[model samples]
Target chain A: MPKSLVSLLIVLLSVLFATAQTKSSSAPSDLPPGSTSLIDPEDLLSELQSQQGEKPLVFNVGPSILYMQAHIPGSEYVGATSDKQGLERLRTRVKTLPRNQPIVVYCGCCPWSHCPNVRPAYNELQRMGFTNLRVLYLADNFGVDWVDKGYPTTKGQ
Target chain B: MRRIVLVIVVIAIAIAVYEAARHSSHAKGHPGAVDSPAPQFSLQDLDGKALSLANYQGKVVLLNFWATWCTPCRGEIPQFIEFQNTYGPQGLQLIGISMDDDAKPVHEFYQQFKMDYPVAIGNANLAESYGGVLGLPVTFLIGRDGRIAAKYVGATDMTALQQKIQSLLQAR
Candidate 1:
């Protein structure tokens, strides 16, 4: 009922509200600043389907099992970037490409917050000076975000 | 009086936001599988022992596709170990299919967690057989009759999953 008590309560409530917003938005916190390197599933699908302009080289940086089950057609499997070997393979794959080449990487192995692959791959590419890299934002996983959405996919090695 | 009302409103909004975020992160449960036959697979466990779906026939099976590197999958392991201990005698068989690229971490995880279920390294074929396991922590509940009962994707609601397992165990 006191004015001071009300002011304290308001401050506490503001902190709580701010904390909630931070936690909810933490899913993309691992991404690059501004999350400008991220691409939505729908946008990537449109780009793939349009076949207009210079086509980006799409890479699957998740597990091979998921890649074999379903993946964006024509996306090269770079293995799980969380592993040492997978990272090496990714570097090898892109070593010859121009630094400015349009590239997209995705790892729909789990939720966006939990994916252990994409961040590493994205960081590696960034360190390698790739300016045109984009990480596909699969909020859930591939099955729910892309494959289940009826996006074009092909299963195989 | 006005301050009290403002505090109440703020509290209510905070609670709403918390609940909404919690539910959104919880596993998305799929509609019950149309009683389709459970996909059969024979694989070798960490100990190189034969682990097969047929081995658990006539029992309620909780087939979980996970990987050691998967954070949500790791979160579910302890609860699953408890489930196996509590429900093993009740015809509940918890089987794990690790989708990890290697089996070494899975082996370590198995011992560290004291997992009571049979976990085998999963392959692309095995994943595809179950309608494509394109994600981590995908779970399938199979009835005693070897038919799929329910499927859950992402981090599941453990309470609801336990209840479902109980019902399935009671069915036969």
Candidate 2:
């Protein structure tokens, strides 16, 4: 009933509204610590085509079916980052490798924004001290980014 | 006095709508909300047995959309099996929906993993109904009230998932 009470309520409501917006905002700039800097699919393709520098170890961190369907040429099949066991498997795969060796990870399971497997895998690699880690950005899916672009890809698991 | 009462109601409604919209966007798979009724669906399990969201009524449900091709999806199956076996007695029903195209691989993975829970084939339509499955192994936690409780988008921690299941089971 008091004016003061109503003014306090309005201020509280405004703060709550702002908090909700921040919580739900999934802007690209708000990338998680678990994420890696994105590498353009086209750039990777060109780099591969140039065959100038040392080739990076590329890993397909998507579904096995997608790998079998068509993945970047010479990309090794790493487990998806969807569950702990898969992450563990990937850890085992790179456990003994040289930490400084350049590595690129991509998963065309879905859009770059929503891929469940790429970020965790990227974070794990970073945590393992893989300094040259890169995430191949697939804006839509692999079919659109890599395959459609006529990039070299290998078939079968 | 009347103005204050009206203002309070408006503030409450605004907060409610904001929360709902935020949650809806997060679902990326389906716009399922924590107290809202879980979406319904009817599909054939791996054994061709018909299953509907209604079948798991009165029980806490963990609806998983996975793919055998997804290592993480495959990796998470053991826990689902464990939850089903451990909590099935306590009214926890686990349903796995494989997003894989061919049923052959799914069947092979199911048997190889010795999955004890019911698994069904999930299509894009099924995925769209839930929220667009952005990636493999999207998991949904549904309460006994037949409402969605949570959606885990990526690699899930087994210990945390179990703890939540325990709490939900005790809620009844």
- CA lDDT scores, all candidates in order: 0.87, 0.76
| Segments of candidate 2 deviating more than 4 angstroms | A1-107, A110-157, B1-24, B27-30
Isolated chain B TM-score per model:
0.80, 0.82
**Any runs in candidate 1 off by more than 4 Å, and if so which?**
A1-24, B1-32
DockQ of each: 0.38, 0.08
| Model 2 steric clash pairs | A64-B69, A82-B155, B29-B130, B29-B131, B29-B132, B30-B130, B30-B131
lDDT of 2: 0.76
Q: Measured by TM-score, how close is model 1 to the native structure?
A: 0.82
